[model samples]
Target: MSGQGTGRKARLAGSLLPPPGPARMLAVAALVTSLGFGGYTAGSVLFFTRGAGLSTGQVGVGLSLAGLLAVGGNILFGRLADRWGPREITMVVGGLQVVALLLSTVVDSFAMFLPVVCLLGVSEQAGKVCRNALIGGAVDGDDLVRTLAYLRSVLNGGIAVGAMLASIAVRYDTRSAYQILLFAIAGVSLFGYSLYLFVPRTRPAPRLRKKKDFPKAPPSISYVFTGLLCGIVNLGDTVLTVGLPLWVIGQTAAPKPMAAWLHAVNTLLIVLLQVRASRGAKTITGATRLLRLAGWTMAAACPVFWLAHDFPAVWASIALLIGVLLLTASELWNSAAIWGLSFSLAPAEARGAYLGKFSIGTTLREVFGPVLVIGLITGTGGSGWFLLAGLMAFASACAGPVVRKAQRESGVSDGTLARGRSGSG
Candidate 1:
């Protein structure tokens, strides 16, 4: 009876925590890393402008420079990961985060902070590639997709927790308040690194092919279309994070704080539904189909957003919530689909490099989206959103053909390896 009780307790504990494995360890690392970055980001503007005594202009310049460095680093470190290994690089990335956050807390000048900002940026991008690549190289098939979804859910959970803590600093609105947030963030970074230390060491993946004999050929046309389709859908980042909130304020009759609430809904939905959504994402065809459908769901949400202005206050709130719900739901599907497709598309040996290139789509969208949103999406109002939605749906339709063509170009006609290995280009 005592032995039975011990077994039951262990089973319960295992269920509550992650099952004992690298996946759980990776999830914990992702949680703490996201927490630190999220908190740092929430308090950052005030930290630089008030606490550190830098002008808004100084802050923007520093950030833009850092972003450029990070963009370059993703591609560079990707190749490096393919060469050296993701595990060692991942450790270095975590260490850099710890050093950068703690150091940034003390810097009082733009000149001093600029380098730190750059370091943080590189750390962020490098960590992203290394972590994803580590998972790609270490895990496979259904377990791969499942783990990816959980890691993402954990990332959002961390951000939510970090943001909640930062809310306290927001209320106090003092340099000390901000400093304390940074201190907490630094501590969280260290915690993440501790989790990183426990991850079982994984071997470096071999290169896809040696380049010594032949000149490197450009990727085929099919690959370009596939990439474009992926990138267009990836623009949901701008839509979910920036466009939706701004649209809520300018276009909808809903209150401003509702925007935050709607985002809460998004985060909550991701936590609840992301893993379920990923169940179908274990293969390329299924993932592609899911992403395609997700686009239409997002499309349907647009007009609901537009029509919210026509209703009275309570009903308008209802319509707006409905729209946000659709959008967030679509986000869940799209995230899972994209994960499977991205994971499967890369060659086994070049998984790191492939994932690195895949990340550039989001980076590119982030760089271009602000202007696109402010100048076009918001400028044209509901009509513009309708147009944007139409384009997304079109992309969804095209995604199937494009992915099929990409599969053909990769020399897979039967779709067996395409589903099983996911090695496209």
Candidate 2:
């Protein structure tokens, strides 16, 4: 690290949140990138249908398939980040994002739109892997979770601002409004990518470390299973983002606007409290505790949502608010826990690769979580919510044994276990 980098790190050490520099750069990039995406998202359906002349079904099917295709980028780039270093790959991906945006902007017909959207999807995934690896590498130990929380908090803020601004387009409901927003979004991607150049560069981490240096390291395979477990527990997220809103409208007496208000509360609470929530997550066992907490809280919240369906209108509103609170709690704690565990779960030899593979677990949730949520909850009845809750709680409970198994198999220290630190559970 240069003197400049050293100074930045020192400042960050004392600060409660991520200090300015690479972390700041990533935050700015997240904000602008999310801002642009939000603008388009506010009117994306109209852009595809009226502006691009595509049918509603075409946009739905096309984007869904595109998301599935996009999921492989993390695995594909995991090794690249390992071999070439995160900064190098991140710059390349940023450029690719520019190209993807250009292709999306140029699409005039549905045929062109399909491939362009798929390209955008892949680019989006690639950028997330590169940028996350870059941030993970740039920030030193323990600070990773808090730093990531800061970035996420900023991104949500941007999305909120952008969503508000996007209503102008929605209100006008014109092709010109859609085009202006779309083009502006492409511009935002270009600007954000350019800023990637200013972030400090780093070389690949050392491939070999002696046990004397740090004992109790696990092999790569153990984390794959761990990632799979983390990903499944992460379904709690999809439940909040997708399943809960639907449940509110379809099953409960709460009005449709209540769903939006719940989301607003969720976002606001994250921005306000994510850093404080990250404090207990420095150790692997601590991370497991947080994940377990997230699972049970989410599970517990479901019954509240179900209760809203049967309660009187006044009670229903109260139940729904309580449910949202629990869901938001799960989201905040799970995020910090995942960030710490993901980075800590893997040792130095291939941290980027491990994180990338770990991320696949979340991607798996994004792609298939809706199906599980809809099939179980929507297809059945309010009971489906309880079933989903039980599953999440079980998954949360697995964090401890999984880490212990990884340690036992790889000949690492079960120090946490020996110390009676196998999480609160």
Candidate 3:
């Protein structure tokens, strides 16, 4: 009976993982990629400042510049992926990333660091666009959103593990330790990039040129609008990461350590529930509904967080925990909706370009989200929470109509949007 119980547990665990194939392979690659980058992200500032002899201001400027450049670079790379084939572009981007990471180790001046970091950012952004295109072409529609959800979960898990591992380097607080960690991260990333070789090549999309080969077609503006709305909704993440910690430490009576615990809980919940949230989101209408739900849930959580400041230590902790739960729900739902809509809304042949264009909103948010969330929550105090709630609600309200309009304009039926996937779950 004990042996049987062990066997049953194994089966159940295996059932929770993606079926063995392209999805599984990609998940493994994503996991490895995240593991390396996670550590690098956690420790990059110290590495640049201490090991590379760059100042904090220089690193910040360099990263900001890299981010801005990557915004346009991602779109260009996505188009190239469509024209030149995703597999080939992805391989090229991967090679660039490995080279940039390795070169970063030898940099001793801001001038040298700036170009290497920019190269890294460009490669990273292009890699994301190409991977999305590859998955769109390789995976069946039934599993497209599910595969994305699974990969996200894997990435979160890997990052958490990598962060924990990097704590050793952080504790050492020496240049050599930082350099070693950077080198190890590069090696791991190269290994992860190699795994992409096993993934089947996605068919290249048609070139954007007209029949006469005069001018290329302009990208769709509708996707840009939808992407912006999705990016605004994603400010929920910024709130969780930035607003909550600040509020807990500055305003709430809850223990400051509660902030870290809340983040851990957020990660854990996402890793466990992201896949389940993605269900029923195959259709555009279904995805829109989920977006609305995310907005409503987040709206509710905002007030709860505001109220946490009024509570004593224990009650404040409880209230904050509940708020995190609600926010996590919002995050999960929003992510699922975005994945479904991004995949469903694109023209199949222009998948890479569309995906890259859709990502512009996210890129803008990364640039602006933290500042906006902090201003809203900390600047206005309690009123700011209600204002944020209203903003999210408004964005959510707009999402459904926007999606419907896009669907109509594109002349894509729910069946066509879902491809072989089931409608409305």
Candidate 4:
């Protein structure tokens, strides 16, 4: 009987993997989109600082403002996706991004570039919302978690590759090289947009005839609270994206290739470990467990930056890699669990609004996270890591109860509680 039970569990695990079907095809489309976005992001700092001739301070401000615009774009498109549908928004946004990239090649002035970045931010928001919404709509049960994990891994990998290509382009110092990179980005984005052509249109779920289509109850305040916690946790990415690279370049002797190694480590871990992490998290209930794990992991990893001071370059690289592994694992769980919880908890008619609210949380993180990290590093010198660690711990503590409340409110159980209650009864 025990052997039979073990076999059933194994089969269930196997079934959770996304099968080669339309869902898998959509995942592929998502991969292509990631490649384009990743390539652009990897090259953005260099382009702004070198290609467009912006000072470091100006670059920081421009990037922060772009992040703010991204928040708006994410919320706007998320609401649009909920109101209209994912397919239309994906195509429109992806197409716009292609145009934005093409326009970027010609913009010679900072003023011209700023508006373009804002437009690109909108495109980024639309593409991300549509792709994520599609994945939510397409997959079911445990497969949904696995699918999202796989997608994130692919996205990170694409970013790594794009960054590498951008490095090569910048090395050439030829006008043609930059132009080629821009056109390549546009081409990949177009390919990604083309995938939307194949996606079937889904109608909004029917409203209850007995009541109004609007939410009958007051909005769940827990959602907003949860969003704030999420924003705090998301600040970790700002450290990863901007802080780490800058630290490596400024402190280390080998500035040129350091960013590549950092990006590679981040991407490699996600690609290899994300699906495994999702599998482990299958029995974990609610967003709290994941959020707590992320918070603690981030907090622990933050202080490890001090190790860079003592170690040889290779050893430091390894230590940083280990730190990133823990960070990415936290990311793998919190991201999937949060999205799943958000969708599950949202009123059927208000999924879009809820997603918009969620985007706002992320946007707040993006805007403030970078500025805070930059300030802490510049002001206090080496204490930025400790500050980040403390913030993460605080956020994690706040997230736990909210996630628990969400689980109870949604009437979902993670098996253990149900079994325990049945046994007790």
Candidate No. with top lDDT: 3
How much is the lDDT of residue 334 in candidate 1? 81
Give the Cα error of residue 129 in candidate 1, in Å: 1.5
Q: Taking the tens digit of each residue's C-alpha lDDT, what string does model 4 give over 1-425?
A: 99999999877544433467656677677777777777787676677677767777876776678778887687677666655666677788888889889998876777887888778877877577666665555555456667777777767766777767777778875556777788898998899779867766643444422234533321666766677787788776777777777766665433447765766666677776676676544443544577788888888887676466457788776667777777776676667656655555554444555666666677777778777877765456667778878988998887768867755664546532111100000
Judge candidate 1 at residue 245 and give its lDDT.
Answer: 80
**Taking the tens digit of each residue's C-alpha lDDT, what string does model 3 give over 1-425?**
99999999987556446778988899999999899888987887888998778898898788878878888988888887777677778888988998998898888998899999999888988898898887777688888888889888988989989888888899998888988888889899989888888888775523433434322322456657778888888888989888889999999999999999999999998888888888878888788889889988998999999989899999999999999999999999999988888878777677777788888877777667777888988898667999999988898888888878777766677744533321110
User: How does candidate 1 score on lDDT?
Assistant: 0.73
Tell me the spans in candidate 1 whose CA falls farther than 4 Å from its real position. Answer: 1-18, 53-65, 107-114, 205-228, 412-425
Best by TM-score: 3
Q: In model 3, which runs have C-alpha deviations exceeding 4 angstroms?
A: 53-55, 205-219, 418-425
Q: Residues 1-425, candidate 1, lDDT per residue (tens digit)?
A: 99999999986544333455778888888888888878887788888898889998888778767776876787677765655567667877778887888888888998898999889888887788888877775555558877888888888888989888888888898778888888889888888877766766555422334544222221445654555566666666677677878877777667878878888888888876777777777767888888897888888887887787667767878887898788877777788876766666666555566666666655556566655655555788567777878877998999888777766666543323213331221
**Model 3 Cα displacement at 234 (Å)?**
0.7
Cα error, candidate 3, residue 359 (Å): 0.5
Candidate-wise lDDT, in order: 0.73, 0.72, 0.82, 0.68
Ranking by TM-score: 3, 1, 2, 4
TM-scores for candidates 1 onward, in order: 0.86, 0.86, 0.92, 0.84
Cα deviation at 142, candidate 2, in Å, is 2.8
Lowest summed-lDDT stretch of 10 residues in model 2? 416-425
